[model samples]
Each structure stands twice: as structure tokens, then as C-alpha cells.
Target: MKVVAIGGGTGLSNLLRGLKKEVGNRIEDLSAIVTVADSGGSTGRLRKAYHIPAPGDIRNCLVALSESEEIIQRLFQYRFKGGELDGHSFGNLFLVSLMDITGSFISAINVASQILRTKGEIIPATTEDIHLWAEFSNGEVVEGEENITEYGKTSKAKIVRVWIEPPDAKPPIDAIAKVQSADLIIFGPGSLYTSIVPNMLIEDIKEAVEFSNAVKVFVVNAMTQPGETDSYTAYDHIEAFLRTTNLSKIDITILNTKMPSDVVLRRYIEQGQEPVIPDVAKIARKGITVYAEDLIGESQDFIRHDPDRLTEVILRAVSHALS
Candidate 1:
């Protein structure tokens, strides 16, 4: 199976980690198309200074796919405690430095992957330096991925549309080709608006996905994101994708059946978040096959999708699709 996972941040990274362990032997090709619209924290600083795409998500994905020594991975993930480089990750700086030396972001990533002995390929959705812009229903426009999330939280209106700057920004050819050739295309398990949707905002990437012959799967989030997806249900998540992209339908939608413990639920509720209700009927009405399962797992009191369980479910789905 040639699997292509799309999205950004920890969700995509975690998914890659599990897939690396489960499907690496079965499939020789696994590629991740990560969003690069981030404009906050260390990534933002590096982007501004060097005029390059965000490297934070790429670094995370590289480390997740790494098969190197434990110390190498730890060192790559190390963040400075305090000083001028406070909150900056060693991996991010290393990638940026490689970009400077190689004169190409893609080349820099290739070098980093070799250094980490990564199991699969990691590709950015676009090589251009881009920023995300969101327009709310109330006519408020927020620029930058970081600002869009923060602004969406306090706004009374819902996001009407989102696009990338330089509306004609081209996606990396390799990214589009990977989607065109993928046997399975996965979306989400990340922030809906900022992380996942930003990649779709690119015309070529979205078009390739819509036209792909692969079984398209969307991994619904276990919990609602406070700023971006407040009060969003499983059906709402799918609807948002349909509304934003030219894709007519998704083949399968994976919904988490288990809820967190009361204590964990309480903690999330306190933070203005709640478990995403699996509205199976509504989602099924859209002609999507709903695969509901006990996919929830806790990590340090934080509710997350169990990586191993998720991989199992996905593999089963792929088998069923093929059979």
C-alpha cells in the first residue's frame, strides 16, 4: 500500500509514528504532506528571518518517522530552557541551517531524514513561504494561522472561507504526484482549520485529492478544538470539509466510540472543550461509511487517539476496501 497522510502538527506526527511501526513492512512507500502556514513561535521567527516555510511541523514528522538512536531523537527534540533561543527546538534550527546550506527546503528535509534514519518520506505541502487567511461570516478577516485560531475563539461569527496568500501559490509537484499515486489518502487527526484545511487551500493539492482513485479516509478528532472547532460534531467535521473543498465525498469517516474518564472529561470541559459526538446517522446520510470504534486513549490526562488502535482500524479498513 502506498499511503499518503496529510495534515500538520502532533496529530500527523503521532499517526506517522504508529504507521511506521505497523505498515512499514507491508508498504515500502509512506509519505506525509504537512501544512506549512504556521506563523507563530519559533517557526514564525525562523520564517520571518530566513523567508522560508515553517519547519516545526516538518521537524516533528521527521522525528516521528525516525529510526535513529534514542539519544539522537532526544537531542533533535530538545528545546532550549532559557536565553535567546528559549522555546526553540534543536531540530527546527538544524533544518533551517540545512536550508541555508542546500539552497532548497526539500533538499534540507532529505538531509534531515537521512540523519534521523527516517522510515518514510516527509514532504511539505508547498515550498513557498505562505500565510493563512480566514474570513469570518461577519466579514472579519484574520491573517496568519496563529492569529486565525485566536481570533476565531472570540468572534461571534463562523469562518466562511480560508485561503493562502499569493492565491496562486504552487504546491510541491512531489506532493501532488504522491496523492495521485496513493492507494490510501488520510486527512486530519489535527486542527481542522489551521493544520489540515490549510493544505487543502492549495488548488493543486485539493484537486489531486478530489481526483485520486484511492480510498479517502478522514480521522475525526476525539475532542473539539476550543478555538477552531468549538462545538463541532463528527457530522460537522465532515460537512466543513465538504464545504471547503471541491471533493464531493469521503469514502470512510473514523469516529472514536469511547469517551474519556470523568476526570479527564471534566478537565477538558473546564478548558471549553468536549468529546466530539459521533453523529453516525447524519454522517452516514452523506454517503460516507462510518467506522466507529473505541479509539480513545489518555496521555498524561490528555485525551488522544490511541495510535496502535488507530493503525489497526485503518489497516482493517484498507483490507475491506481491497477485498
Candidate 2:
């Protein structure tokens, strides 16, 4: 099977961790189209200094698919403390250095992938030094991926819409090809506005998805993101995505049926996050199949998709795509 997963760091990387294990056996080809419009912390600083697309998410995805030794993986993830390089990740720095050496951002990623011995392909959605911009429901426009979320939180405004600058940024050569040939295309299980939607802002990438015969699946987040999907239900998540990006459809959606313990729930609620109510019947009514599963898993008291369970769900989605 040829599978493509699109989104940003953390959630997408978590998925890749499991999907990588399926390579060469159940899957013939796997590719990731990652958002590179991050404008926060180390990535933003590097992008400003180096005049290249954000490498942080790409770095995380590469490490997630990495078949390298444990130490090598750690080295890529390592962040310096209390120094000139205090906040920079080793992997981001490595990729940037290689960008200077290779004369292109994509080539740098290729070199890093080989060093990591990644199991599948990781491609940036665009190579342009780009920034994400969002208009709030309050009639204010904000630039920078992190700022949009933060602004929505502090100002108590929903994101009106989002778009990428340059408006014509191009995806890597293989990105569109992979999506076009893909048997399955997966979006999200990441920040809706910042991570996933940014990929759709690229013209050809969105068109490829619109035109592809691949079964499209959206892995809904189990819980709302405080600053982003503060009160989004399962239906709201899907609606927001399609509404914001103008993507044609989602064939299937996998929603988490399980919730965290009361103590955990209370803690999250305190911080303004909550379990996403999986409105199964509502989603199914839209001619989209809903697969509600017990996909809950905890990491350091935070709720996230269990990689193993998600991988299993993805394999099932693959069968649906093939059939």
C-alpha cells in the first residue's frame, strides 16, 4: 500500500513511530507531508537566521521514522540547556547546517533521513520560508503559527480562517506524486489550524487531495486543544478543517471512545481542555463512516492517541481503501 500522512510534529511523529514498523510488510510506500510554517522557539529563530523553511517538524518526523541506534536518536532530539544554543534541538541544527551545505532544504532533509536510516519518506509541504496567518472571529489578523493559537486564547476569539503567505509556495516534487498515487491519505491527529490545515493551504497539495481516489481519513483528536479547539466537538473538528481549507471530503473518521480517568479529566478541564465528544451518529450522517474506538493512552499525564492502537486503526483504514 502507498500511504501518506499529513500534519505537524508530536501527533504526526507519534503515528509515524508505529507506521514505520509496518513498512516493507503491510505497506509498500509511506510518505509524510509535514507543515513547515512553524514560527516559534528554536525553529522560528533558525528560520529567520537561515532563510529556510522551518526544520523542526521535519526533524521530529525523521527521528520518528528513524531506524538508527538509540544513541543516535537521542542525539538528534537533544536540546542544549543554559547556553547560546540553549533552546535549539540537535536535529534542527543539523538539518540547517546541511541546508547550507546541500544548497536546498529538501536535499538537507534527504541527507538527514539517510543518517537516521528512516523507514519511510518525510517531505515538507513547501520549501519556501513561509509564515502562517489567521484571521480571528474578532476581525484581527495574526501571523505566525504559535501566535494564532495564543491570540485566540488570550482574546477569547475563535479562528476565523487561516492561510499561508506567498500563497503560491510549492510542494516538493514527490509530495504531490505520493498523494496522487496514495491508496490512503490521512490528515490530522494534530493541531487543526496550525499543523494540518497549513498543508492544505498549498495549492497543488490541496488539489492533489481533492483529485485523488485514495480513501481520505481524518484521525480526530481525543481532546480539545486549549487555545485552538477549545470547545470543538468531533463534528466541529471536521467542519473546521473542511471549512478552513476547502477540502472536498473525508471518507472516514476515527474518533476515540475512551476518556482519561476523572483525576486526569479534572486536571485537563482546569486548564481549559476537555475530551472531544465523539458525535458518532452525527458524523456518520454526513455519508462519512465513523470508527469509534478505545484509542486512549496517557503520556506524562497528557492525553494522546496510543500509537499501537492508532497503527492498528490505520491498517484497518488501509483495507477499506483497498476494498
Candidate 3:
């Protein structure tokens, strides 16, 4: 099976871990198309100084697929304490050093992948250092993914459109070809604007997804995000996807069925967020098949997708499609 997962951050990494465990050798191919719009934490600092595409998400994906020792994985994820490099992550520094030595980000990633012995391929949506620009419904334009989340609500910025500057930037040819040849394409369980939608803003990447022969699926978030996807339902999530990209209906939409404990729910509410109480039947009525499962991975104050359960649901959907 050739599976191509798209998005950035922990969501995609966690999903990859599950897929790796479940498919074993039967999965002949796996690839990730990660968003490079990150501008926070170690990645943000590195981007400011080196002018390289953010490596945080890409690094995470690499480690997730690594067939390496736990110690090596820990080394990549470790963060130094209380120094000039205090805020920088070990993986971020490793990637920058590799790029500096190799003189190219793509080549650096290739080296890193070999060191980790990752089972799958990973590529950026674009090799260029591009920023994400969002035009809100109120006619105000937000320039960066990090900035969009801080805009106040009365601002009424509806994310009217998103585009990459130097709009002619092309995605890595390997990334585009992977999408075109995918048996199944998956998007999101991550931040709507920052992760999934940012990748779609790259014209070439979006075009490849539109032209792919694979069945596309969106793993909807279990909770609505504050500032970006506030008050959004399951269907609203799908609608936002269509509004952002040129693609039409997604073949399958996965929704989390198990409600989180009240303690966890309260903590989320304190943060101005809430579980996405989706009208599942109504979502199905919209023509996209909906699959409900126990997708929540336990966390201290929040809930996330259980990598195993989430992967099971996704593989089942893709398997059904293939059949």
C-alpha cells in the first residue's frame, strides 16, 4: 500500500507511528508532505537566523518513522536548558547543521533520514522559505501562521483566502509525484490554518492533490481550536477545507466518538476551547461518509487521537475504498 499523509506537527507524527505498527511490511510505501509554515519555538528562531524552511515538523515526522534506538530518538527530541541554545531543540539544531554542511535542505533531510533509518519518505510542501498570508472576511490581512492565531475576535477575520508569497514557488518534484501516485491521501487532525491549509496554499501541491487518483480523506479534529476554528462543527471543518483548496468532496471523514472525561473537558474549557460536538448524521447527509471511533489519546488536560485507534479507522476506510 502506498499511503501519503499530509499535515504537520504531532498529529501527523502520531498517525504515522500507528500506521507503521499496523501495516508492517504489507505497506510497501509511506510518505509525508509536511507544512513548513512553522515560526515558533526552536524552529522560529532558526528560521529568523538562517532563512531556512522550518524544520520542527519535518524533524518530528522523521523521528516518528525511525527504526532506531530509543536513545537516538530522545537525542533528537531533547531540549537544552538555560543557555543561548536553551530555547532551541536538538533536532532543530541537528537539521540546521546538516543543511549548513550539505548546502541544501533537501540533501540535509536525506542524510538525517538515513541516520534515523526511517521507514518512509518525508518532504516539505515547498523548498522555498515562504510565508502564509490570510485575508479575513473583514478585509484585514494576516501575514504569518503564528500571527493569525493572536488576532482578536471582533476582528471578524474569516480567513477569506490563503496564499504563499512568490506564488510561483514549486513543491519538490518528489513530493508532487508521491501525491499523484498515492493509493490514499490523508489530511489533518492538526491546526486547520497552520498545518493543513498552509500546505494547500502552495499552488503546485494543491494541484497535485486535485489531480491524484487516490481517495482523499480528512481526519477531522476532535475539538474546535480557539482563534482559528472557533464554533466550527464537523461539517464546518469540511467546508473550510473545500473553501481553502480546489478539491471537492472528500471520500471519508473520521470523527471521534468517545467523549472525554469531565475533568479533561473542564480544563479545555478554561482554555477557551471545547470538544467538537458534531452532528454525525447531518455530516453524513452532506454526502461524505463519516466514521466514528475511539480516537482520543489520553493526555493530562486535553484529549488527542489514539494513534492505534485512529490508524485503524483510517486504514479501514482506505481498505474499503480499495475493495
Candidate whose lDDT is highest: 2
Native-vs-model 2 lDDT? 0.91
Query: Which sections of candidate 3 miss by over 4 Å?
Result: 152-157
Q: Put the candidates in lDDT order, highest first.
A: 2, 1, 3
Alpha-carbon local distance difference test for all models: 0.90, 0.91, 0.85
In what order do the candidates fall by TM-score, top score first?
2, 1, 3
lDDT of 2 by residue, 1-323 (tens): 88899999698998998888889988899999999999888999898888789999999999999999999999999998897999999999999999989998888999999999999999999999889999888899999988888998899899888998899999988999999999889997999999999999999999999999998999999889967898899999999999998988999999999979888889888988989999998999999888899997866587889988898997896697567
Which runs of model 1 end up more than 4 angstroms from their true locations?
A: none
lDDT of 1 by residue, 1-323 (tens): 89999999889998898899855476668999999999989999998998899999999999999999989999989999899999899999999999999999999999999999998899999999999999988899999988888887777468878888978889888998899999999997999989998888889998999999999999999999877888999999989977876578789999998978888899889988999999999999988888999997776577888888998898788779878
User: What TM-score would every model get versus the actual structure?
Assistant: 0.97, 0.98, 0.95
- Residue lDDT tens for model 3, 1-323: 88899999888998888877745555778899999888888898899898889899999999999999999999999998996989788998999999999998899899999999998888998888988777787888887777777662446456767777767877899998899889889998888888888888888888888888898899989988877888888888888888887676688999987789888988888887788876788888888888988789777655889888888888888889789
C-alpha RMSD of candidate 1 = 1.1
Q: Which ten residues in a row have the lowest lDDT in candidate 2?
A: 314-323
Q: How many Å off is the CA of 61 in candidate 1?
A: 0.3
